[model samples]
Target: MNNTETPSFEEWVHYCFTQGYSDFHTEPDADHYEAHEQRRQRFVDIDPKALSEHIIRLFSNPAFLADEYTDQQIADAVWFIFGLATTYFLHLRSEVVPRNVQIRCIESVATLYTDLFDRLCDKHDVDPNKSSSKDTPLEDAVYMIWDMDCIEGAVMFPKHWPHLVDPGFRVLETILEKCRTVTCKESALHALGHIHMYHPERVEKIIDKFLASPDQPGVLREYALDAREGAVQ
Candidate 1:
């Protein structure tokens, strides 16, 4: 592609996976994060809805279906999508558009994210309903997206606004109930706490249940307590 030409969604995805951005950024080396943000700006002009659709289409592509790409590469690409989509919706929220219009645009992109999540699970053979301690690439990708989109992305809705983001409250509730991983639960609780002022009753009820559950680990309960304290503070 020429320098002046806008990279197609597929091209950008390929660049993200094949280039340096997909590599894990060990802390103290913030270059990877900066690289990701810089590359993401390349397609800032593309409609988020369109970009999300391109991601969905990627699963069925001949190259993706063939044994050409490793699971790690695919996971890395999807990770990039989560960050990019988050940027898009956050931008939408900041726009001067009517509230309903902003919600509509966000909903469209959010729905695509939900679709993309399911496709990744099915195609990559990761079971979203089951929690495992395994650090396999596909599993990590699925859970990361779940945490990023459903948990973090959900709480980011404007204060006192109804939960309109796809993969929002309902999905997070499911993750809390079904996913046995403590780290995942901690992240979910932390996110809920972050939004607690806007969703006090719901957040408190869920965290209360988690704290009361005998099966939950002590560390998780402590995290929950800290989250509650943070919320009130």
Candidate 2:
């Protein structure tokens, strides 16, 4: 209940399962789901609102996590938190969650995410940029898309949508649209996503439109589509 008193991992999971399965979610990784299932069931049938309030209170505390949680644990928890919050209050419920609330939520998870990343980087004894691994549950579902207003859900490419990662074009577009930092957006757009959805045409179009851009942002030419070879220019 208090910030200094963290919950056990088992407690956090029980809290969620008691609330009921996430209303708007893809299945979590098998291992992650299995781990949570080991905890007490949170919701077979219960008041969604009360459960949501309980969830909010639980995670709001800095001490909400189990000491042994890894990046995966933090990532999963973040997704569940957002999913529960949006389903019960934001999105179809209300469009706006104040900035202060949003900032606090993000800051709460920052340490964990950063720690996870640090651990991985350390294990490999390499810089994150040098690390070959390209994906994390946090990047796609948590950090990249988390915004104060919940204006858009997680902005990173879906694993199923490998094309979205193409040349970092659409990925950048996604970031700029859903993400907050300009530097990070640019980095993601130009470098990070080089595998699939790389559309240069869309980039041209976006650049042209934004040359005199007003505000809301614009999408480029071959973006979201294949613009390659002769099609690129």
TM-score of every model versus the real structure:
0.52, 0.33
What digit string (tens of lDDT, one per residue) describes model 1 on residues 60-167?
242443255566776665465455543544444443544555444434433333333333333434343433323466546554553454325545554534435433
What's the true lDDT of residue 70 in model 1? Answer: 69
Clashing pairs in 1: none
Candidate 1, which ten residues in sequence have the lowest lDDT sum?
110-119
Residue 108, model 1: lDDT of 42
Give the C-alpha miss distance for residue 216 in model 2, angstroms: 28
In candidate 2 the C-alpha lDDT for residue 153 amounts to 28
